[model samples]
Target: MNKRMTGVMAAGAAVITLCASSALAAAGRESSADMRGVSVLVGGGVEGYTRGLGADIQPGAAYGATVILRPTKVVGLELGYAGASNNFDRSNVAVSEATRGPDVMRNGGQAVATLGLTASPVQPYLLAGLGISRYNVRATAAGFQDDTVGNVPLGGGLRVHLGHFTADARINYNVLVDQQLATDLPSTSATSSTGGIYTGTVNLGSTF
Candidate 1:
């Protein structure tokens, strides 16, 4: 009889131990699964960019957000928006046979879509995206006037996650698709342009 009682107690202890182990493993799995989901973030910041023929545009304010659909631990799709203004600087001068002079400034907004690859929870990533931009140029002699433009930008950047939010810095070499000539300027004046838009951007966002 004593032998039978000892055996029963041993069996009960074994079952309890197995149940505890199972519970711990289940909790660990849930924690890992939480890493994969839809995250929405918004941020406002700045960028330095250029827009038409030669390299000459200044920095301006920019703001935007990214919505990420993370399917796995390392892959996702990010839909983002960014807007920046271009202010002209005389230091951006070109030497030409026509003339050497100051020109107009340009600024605008961009809507973008990117596919990204992440390496960690607080990850640094790379993205290839397309941007739809509306550019406006303002000359000091005249008020602010603008031209609409479209571009395809292939780029990459880094992101840092701090609990509820993330901060990012990115650079894009935007190739303008539509080419518009500014021949209306006085024929004797130097025909310098803003150039293909190249941008360096930084923004902050929070996840919900």
Candidate 2:
């Protein structure tokens, strides 16, 4: 990763830690009715690529589920799983017009620490996490291999609570370390070991 991206991730982590500490301390003074204990959400959206991955891949569909555990009104922990399938750029790869290139599927899981900005029905939050992503190439080509990379996810979102149900819209920028995609394909030029994945999702679920 570049120095700028590394600095951003470090700053975000510091902010999340500070906010979490404040929220946990304030939780004891808040009323019990304001607490949200747990929730689960399932949804689908879209994901785009950046840096090295963007050179040979096209944006596509994404789906995922998330489980949130909140110990206080303003602090929570999120566990999430996401999968995406993107088509390869035919012009960049050595594939003919009659046959499209292989599908690039990415599956990942994350554990994030969240801090809500407010205690209202509509709340905005910040999150930072660590994750592992597996990139699989689904093609008939020989000598191809799959790769797994560690990632740092940093982003924020908005959550709206309606009675016992909640709706959330979020976006995350995943900074991938040691990611290698399309390296085995002929005529491919993306050689950078670091890349990024940009994801946007909306989820709906019940709160407990």
- C-alpha root-mean-square deviation, each candidate: 19.6, 8.9
lDDT of 1 at 204: 53
- Which digits, one per residue and each the tens of the lDDT, describe model 2 over residues 1-208? 3343344445444543444444445544334233487999887667777765676667777789999998877898989998988776666654433335437788989899989999865578999999998888775333334788777889998776655666677778887765645454332223324357887766778789
Residues 1-208, candidate 1: write the lDDT tens digits: 1243334335434543443344335534334323346667555443444443333444544456667766765565776665665445445533132222323333434445444464443444566555565554444322223555566666766554444444555666766654342333222122224445545555555544
For candidate 2, what is the TM-score? Answer: 0.74
TM-score versus the correct structure, for each prediction: 0.57, 0.74
Candidate 1: give its CA RMSD in angstroms.
Answer: 19.6
How many angstroms is residue 15 displaced in model 1 relative to the true structure, after the best TM-score fit? 49
Candidate 2 lDDT at 191 equals: 30
